[model samples]
Target: MSVQPTSAPTWHRLSPRMLAIHPIIELGRALPALVGVFFAGHAGGHGLLTSLAVAVAVVAVSITRWFTTRLRITDEQVQLRHGLLRRRTVATRRDRIRTVDVTAHLLHRVLGLSRVVVGTGTSDRKNESRIVLDGLTAVGAESLRRELLHRTPVAMTNQGSEPADELARLERSWIALAPFTLSGVVTGLLVWGFAWRVEGESGVDLLHSGPLRAVGHGLDAAPTALAVVVVGAAILVFVTVTSVIGYVLAFWNFRLVRHDGGAVQVTRGLLTTRATTIERRRLVGIELSRPLLLRAVGGARTLSIATGLRVGRGAEKGGEVLLPPAPVDRARAAAARVLNGATALTVDLVSHGLRARRRRYVRALSGGAVLVTAAGVGWQTGGSLWPVPVAVVLLATSVPLAADRAAALGHAHVDGALVTRSGSLIRRRVVLADHAVIGWTLHASLFQRRAGLSTLTATTAAGRQGYRVLDVETPVAIALADAVTPELLSQFRRRPAPAPRATMR
Candidate 1:
């Protein structure tokens, strides 16, 4: 008997607007090389020809890419086929979709187009397996996002009118808290790096640039204290301005919405807009962050500790962020709302006791003590008084830092969630749901054991994988683990030695 051939799968092409978008994107990506070429051409008197050739090449590649890319959605899976030299096909099950990100860069926005990224829980920094559709009309992208996430055929217009409850919205006043955040420092470093790159490429000495030379001379002519004050003030102003601009650009029109279809969506950004939708089922916990400077200014940020969402490194700007630097009270409120008003956010945490406090002090001061010893040695051998003052300053600061760390150490179990608070420089309170905890680990170093303390870690499949309750009393750690997961350790429980029989003599 002869078998009949099956019909070919329907493949949909990207938006025609991608023809315009891809060229711009490819050209921008090749800018550094274009810059180098421009400099070389200027010197060789072939500037016009070289630039034209490069632009033509970029456009050719862009057109080829647009022609090759296609995507399709079947009942069982979503498939994508793309690439010119190395033709490739990627597919993922409909149920495996964990996140749907809709992004529009400036050019995309201008052309009414968007890019859709579909992520499974399997992706990480090392290994990435994601399906990306580089170009789609804004309405098509939104409709696809809603269809994939909600598993329903929900056609949407360019501007969606789906009813969603607002969880949080960006406030203009929150910009004040931006200076207290590390964003300014990060922005300054990026700016410095870019300047360094430009100087290296152009063979220019930025430090000896005309304006810089004048500033350097002025500083040299001024008194030491005056120069210090002027430099400090200048740095402060730069940081403040950059921070404010960054805050506005990144979080403009930020809004957190909970859709009726059991998903939470976050929409933000100015020049490059992004909308990320995460299933409520994947949300296992929430994190409240208070860095030292941010804490001093009574500001904090909120992040989602959800499965499939990576929350580390640049997580503050990633899809996991729920709220940017805002008042601490507001942060807590957002955390609570995310947790569905779980008491873990507000419940008083159980202290780790005096032994734990001592451990904190010892750990914090060890570095200072070593520095002080080295300073003393330098004073004896090299007669350096500067080391002594530096060591003294460090030692003095360590005491208060140790105290603050001790104050921050605590954990509690409330409403079937384990709430853990730790750290000093970047204090974090992680409220993890009971179901999220797959296992428990108790660890003790030689010093920790000697001090009758152990670190209890709750392992999960969600963000960070493990959340630690640092330096709790040994018995408390064991009891806490047992309380959270009784069945896991029931067979391994230690039995008390049988009471000695009374002597009959």
Candidate 2:
């Protein structure tokens, strides 16, 4: 028996289940407003019936929205027509599509459906630039994802050449490094803020509640030193547990595959699964970022510096991340694979000189001294000597930090690639192709000129646009730019004077 090929879809409607789910999603979003309405009703501005009527109106609008929306997919474009009173149509050419992401939250997963987002990557406006088909069947969503991505003729041609190469997969052992990468302090603050918000809304004081009150009483009864230790241990445990859970949820079953068409696909997540595809051709460079704590454990994360991957306000986490927290060596290896065997990804960087090091220390110490002096003067007026010891400690700590930052600053060129490494607390190493560079900019501040140092910026059309090589000698910065793209800066190069005639002698 032979199987028949599936016919292409002309125009389609979202899964019928969307009729029920869309209203529920909208209602959940409006729940806070509904709550406010209920409170207002209880306060006698409106009655219970009024609140009920308002909610029903919201539900009616959502249901109407579901019925009015239609999706159409064709060889040339994916189009969406949505709206009730004012109909709006959005059409995006198939060729211009850069990312086709499939996301399924808990509700959609339970319903065996997902949301498909087809993006052009040129517009920052989410609704204007993308077509979202919500509540698509799991199978249908996957098919759409594949179809939309492989629509281009170039991609279709490449599809027959070879199978995708598996690049990286989640290793449970890497979870051990989670705590180092996690911002425990930030997490604690967020938790505290959330608790405070909840308490305010519910009219209950969390800190004064039963369990917390009992714990407070117990601490009050215990020795001060013991109480302090207990509190510290509890905070530590909370941070560690939160970090571990967050890491697991964000990276569960994480996998990276290099498709035959030279696109890197990333699929991961626990409760809300997300799959992102980044075309290798759009990739301008790779950045290996290591936070101070992660660096101590020899761990780093890799991000693709590419165009078209900047999704939603450009702050979307994991949008361009190729590797989660892993050993630096592993991250470098993965970067190399993504770059198609580009050795520049792992090449050693050239360090700045002693002058830069001294400058770093002097700047750090001077800043600290100014701050300390301000604090001391304030304390003197306030009749206190408390700022003296604090100043001493701060100035002392700045010395080693400055040294480390200076040591971390370096730049080099390898195999027609420009590499820059910098930062103290968060070490960033970027490897950019020389051909990607479009222009060069040289900057020297007043102090920098005196120090014979200048900063060179290599501007490109993709990635961060400008990658800087900082604190290099003026001549070195110019030489580096000339080496990368001789023609770009050649117009600004100084010419040598002609030799004097022999007859003058």
Taking the tens digit of each residue's C-alpha lDDT, what string does model 1 give over 16-49?
8888888888887776567667766877899668
Mind sharing the TM-score for model 2? 0.84
**Candidate 2 C-alpha lDDT tens digits along 1-505:** 0011123655566777777777788877766566556665676767577668888988898888768887776667777898888999988887777777788888899888898777665422434677787877876666566666654333344244436789999899988888887656667887786666556544556777889999988999999999999999998888788878877877888998988767788888899898887666667788888989999999998887765555333222536778889998999999998887888866777878988888899899998899789878888788567777788789999999998899888998887789998888888899988888989889999998999998899997555678888899988988899888988778877789899877853
* Runs with alpha carbons beyond 4 Å of true place in candidate 2: 1-11, 27-65, 83-89, 122-130, 152-162, 183-190, 217-227, 311-316, 491-505
As a TM-score, model 1 comes out at 0.91
TM-score, every prediction:
0.91, 0.84
Q: Backbone clashes in each candidate structure, one number apiece?
A: 0, 0
Q: Report the poorest 10 consecutive residues by lDDT, candidate 1.
A: 1-10
Q: Which lDDT values do the candidates have, in the order given? A: 0.83, 0.78
- Which residue pairs clash in candidate 1? none
Instruction: Flag regions of model 1 displaced more than 4 Å.
Output: 1-8, 47-59, 155-160, 494-505
> Largest TM-score belongs to which candidate?
1
Q: How does residue 356 of candidate 2 score in lDDT?
A: 83
What is residue 500's positional error in candidate 1, in angstroms?
19
